[model samples]
Target chain A: MNPIANRYTELVGIDHPIVQEGLGPFRTPKLAAAVSNAGGLGTVSMPGMPTDLDAGARTFREHIEECAALTDRPFAVNIPVGVDNNGVVLPFTDIYIRTVLDARRVDQSLAAQLTVLTTSAGFPGDYIGMIKDAGLIHQHKVGSTRHAVKAAEAGVDVIIAAGFEMGGHAPSKAVHSYVLLPNVTEAVDVPVLLTGGVRDARGLASALAMGADGVAMGTRFIASSANSDWHPTYIQAILDAKEGDDVAFDGVYGPCRGLKNAASLKLLNHQEDGTGEVIDAVELTRWKIESMQRAQTTGDVTDGLVLTGQVAAAIDDIIDIAHFVPNMAAGAAEILRGLASALPDTEHAFS
Target chain B: MNPIANRYTELVGIDHPIVQEGLGPFRTPKLAAAVSNAGGLGTVSMPGMPTDLDAGARTFREHIEECAALTDRPFAVNIPVGVDNNGVVLPFTDIYIRTVLDARRVDQSLAAQLTVLTTSAGFPGDYIGMIKDAGLIHQHKVGSTRHAVKAAEAGVDVIIAAGFEMGGHAPSKAVHSYVLLPNVTEAVDVPVLLTGGVRDARGLASALAMGADGVAMGTRFIASSANSDWHPTYIQAILDAKEGDDVAFDGVYGPCRGLKNAASLKLLNHQEDGTGEVIDAVELTRWKIESMQRAQTTGDVTDGLVLTGQVAAAIDDIIDIAHFVPNMAAGAAEILRGLASALPDTEHAFS
Candidate 1:
């Protein structure tokens, strides 16, 4: 078998460069353990989020400890840097970041195992040195090449070039993965993990061929059995989708790609009337919490949004994580081998 | 506001539905006149065909005297159907289709108001019935929905359901058009003109939303000054397509979707295992002559098998046809106006 030869596999020490994103509330200990056990990086979102910095840190410790008990493989935590809409600085944001870092520092077992820390949303450039100094590899997610260059220049260990096609909160720049991946790969010296619209082995092989060292999947993993804690309808909504099914909506700081449904439709109509921007955090938070609870508790797909990538086109069937991840790696390896075998023989090595 | 109430529309008194297939050599003046001026229906392929179908039909005193002196509107004749297959069949299929149809047809005049015939491969479907049936219409082309079913559904006046995502000889069975145009518009009432990957306003408004009264096009038409042909490179390779950019060698009976390069790759590696049924005369002729010539004449797009449906994704800029066709019917009468607005409402009606 042709092995996956990439800087990501070497640096992350995973068999394949598939990294699971930390989807908050949905990123349970079970899902994280399954991803890590499956030979890809599994990440846990900070537990009991929006709590005070100390409470959030304590929850993070308990969760990391739970994951450590389940799988010995490396896992990461995603810390979204809180945005300051007004000029007034929020001390809570700094406390949260510092508290998460301190929590990781104090736990010897967690520190030894948490090989990567991915900071997304707001700028992570200021904290990259501190993250690296904490003895964890620093990874930053950027939506554009400008941001990618900024992250790389800041000495981030890896840059996640999240394309417009990806799920969760995508940047508003709107460059497609086909254009973004190759451009960032050419521009950056560090290993690039291609995120967005990557769902299968063929996608993996295609990404590698396009020069990405690895891929990061959010929607695909969320639909897996390990993620069954959510409503089956939520999972089914994702499974039923094809490439163009999802459209992005403007979230708090940026655009988020999700299944377009009643709620989103309302949001769209509101935007059309210029009423969407006025929704404050309290209203947004209540809507999100209610939507998630209804979706999770009652299996109602229409109640909330399920984040997804354009790669939904390729995902017709959903399989378990145990079978899905390794099979993806193997299938990609096989295709690469076939590609190599098909290459034409050439002369002029001396030249 | 108008709405497209019906999926199919009838002209004159044709028994079958209305569809305008690409007619290459088979695009005859007799054919166009027989289908249209007779009232049943008709279309002439685009001009510049090698044969003198345009001139030949004009020569017939009765043919010229009767129809050429009457009618006004657009008709169609197909551009050459390019295939990336090396000249495996002798005598060039496209030339034969072009020559035969061109020799038989006449240039459209005001009175006759010629509608063009378009064939993706070889000659267009037979036009004897259309000629015999006065005022009857005949347009036949298909990319999906079982070519035979699409072609033979006796109720259809025109049957062209080319997937908006297809490029060239898009066989219908492989990938469904949104799972096969709502299952072939619920298995045909009449008038189904569809083509692979038609781009633009009327394309979306009419075909997908309205269920198509008639639809016919060649890729180059969009690139025309009358259209938006764009850069030759953009037109040729279709802007840096991915590996799955096209589907070829699908083991189906008709042409497949894809760019010339991917098609060429498949052709070079075609299996000689002989486990499958031998290709028939029509299939062989289409592959060897008709498709090959078009590819050669058209250049690398044909070479790369650059037939595309997904190219719809990249076609953001609007062309003139984008403005014209809509206005034509949009301003027509209450009946036409109703048809114009029907599409979006129908699409939204589902939700």
Candidate 2:
């Protein structure tokens, strides 16, 4: 048994203290199920999901069923509330609440598999009560300690402390994980999951050492074969990426970090909401989702916003998802053992 | 006996894989000595050292003697070249060369104790020859991997990689430690010491886990008994500081991170360099040094630019310098031990 177990694994009933965070609309289904099957909880993301609510709900239901069919292990469904889908302000909260209720009505076992519901992009204020009522283990992503505290106060089951290094739509506060994780972990009683800049077992071990209960990795997972759904060229981009290749840009929602490509540069130059974007009030929601899909589906790597983190610099290989998390955990264990043995002798010598 | 020994300890003859980075002008002597005696290398800093060359040299000599008297262990002297102190463009490179030669002339044993000469703030090409001729270990600080590679190419013995969260003058690249460290560590063959956002043993352990040979800390040491030379009120301000209290300002050198006190806020609003600096290149160089000193010795935390880092959020109490590094290293060891036991079992269970 990996000694890396923590409150996160116990709370979510997983074997490992790692989480695959939700990507934008259409990032999971197969990938999410693969992560869950590997003993670490996987997440199916639909941030600003479904341009058409009813049709999107049907798709969401189908995706949930597909993941359930693939893995018996626990998984999560990510819904970024308060995002505008172009001119249509997506009723993401309502869709999320209804999706949970409807999934349970359709199949209780499938509903049970969704051990957690993760929200990001905007304040989950109006939807907390409804989320709790749906009996979902709620996890809210925050970029600063203040936001984490607010989420905890509002009764979020877990706080995901994401730093400025995170890809996709990040918290606007720009607090880094190294500083923000400890502050959030100390400020809240709930288990804190460190997000952003984590790639392997070393990162996992480091997070555990720094008061985080676990870690949530997005970019690392994106580089694996499990994420075959994402463009192969995109994965290659990540493997080839170096420091400074990833940059922050104002997308349709808010601050997004990704490997610099043609789409992101255009987004950066766009006039509007790069600074104080109310993700929910944005009218270009549909365009944003489609752009990511274009990036994901288009064989071309530079066409869509390829969301990623700075940790992309460290990713050099793509592996099977089943082997990815386990191998990383083992490598981290070896390093820890060496340090443990080495540290004691040094301590004694000093004493 | 300490298994934690690395190239850093071997290079400098210290017991622990930790370094006390030179804080800006007016730091060290006692602090440096305390750190060296505690088994980690300590550094006496001199950035924009003194406008008065003669008096500055006397004071510098006196401080070095004091450190030698306090501990026979190896310590370091830091000189940041290309800085203007008041109306004087301090001949820092010249002063550093003369100081090293003079120190050797005065007392050969004292010269032996000065095991390392660290440089930062500007290109070190001109002074590398003098450093090499003196037979002292050479270390250079950099904010980016490109700079690290450059310094490594220059044949520096070590590279001190700093992240954006570091206090005093920081890298203008703004790349963070999590991203920058691995890039630099992978890009260069020389030993790398991580700086910024590290406050305790956990940070030290984390740095080692991430390819760094050792760790360096400045802000963490600032809130310590060893740093009594810094105003009590300024230290108190760090203890009392809430998240977001620190801000980045373009001071004399480049970007500087410090607590946002009245002086800092005024600087923020000023013209070119903030504080109405005009940034005319000439008019502002002198103003930056005085502002920092005013903040350092005035006993008024609000009046001076109180240099600090994001780690200030993690610091809750002051400590004795002698005990600070050792206790931190031990604490880190204990954490690593627990993880080692915990991780191996999990890996075996999964495997």
TM-score for all models, in order of appearance:
0.55, 0.88
Model 2 lDDT at residue B298: 80
lDDT tens per residue, model 2, A1-351: 545666678899987878898886655888889888888889887634565677777777777778889999999988776644453434765786578667866787876888688888776776788778877789999888888889999999998999888888877756677778777877999999989888877777777777788889988888787776777987888899876788888765568888788878766655322343343534555666677777777746677878888788778988788987767666666777767756646457558
DockQ (C-alpha based) per candidate is 0.02, 0.42
For model 1, what fraction of the real interface contacts is kept? 0.00
Which of the numbered candidates is closest to the native, going by highest TM-score?
Answer: 2
lDDT of 2 at B177: 77
Reference-based lDDT, residue A55, model 2 = 79
Which model scores highest in lDDT?
A: 2
Candidate 2's DockQ is 0.42
**How well is each residue in B244-306 modelled by candidate 2, as lDDT tens digits?**
778877766778888887877776667333235345665565666777877777866777778
Interface CA RMSD, all predictions:
22.3, 3.5
Error of 1 at A100 (Å): 3.5
Poorest stretch of ten by lDDT in candidate 1 chain A: A341-350
Best by DockQ: 2
Alpha-carbon lDDT, every model: 0.54, 0.78
> Where in model 1 is the C-alpha error above 4 Å?
A48-53, A86-93, A275-278, A344-351, B1-351
Model 1 chain B weakest lDDT span, ten residues long? B331-340
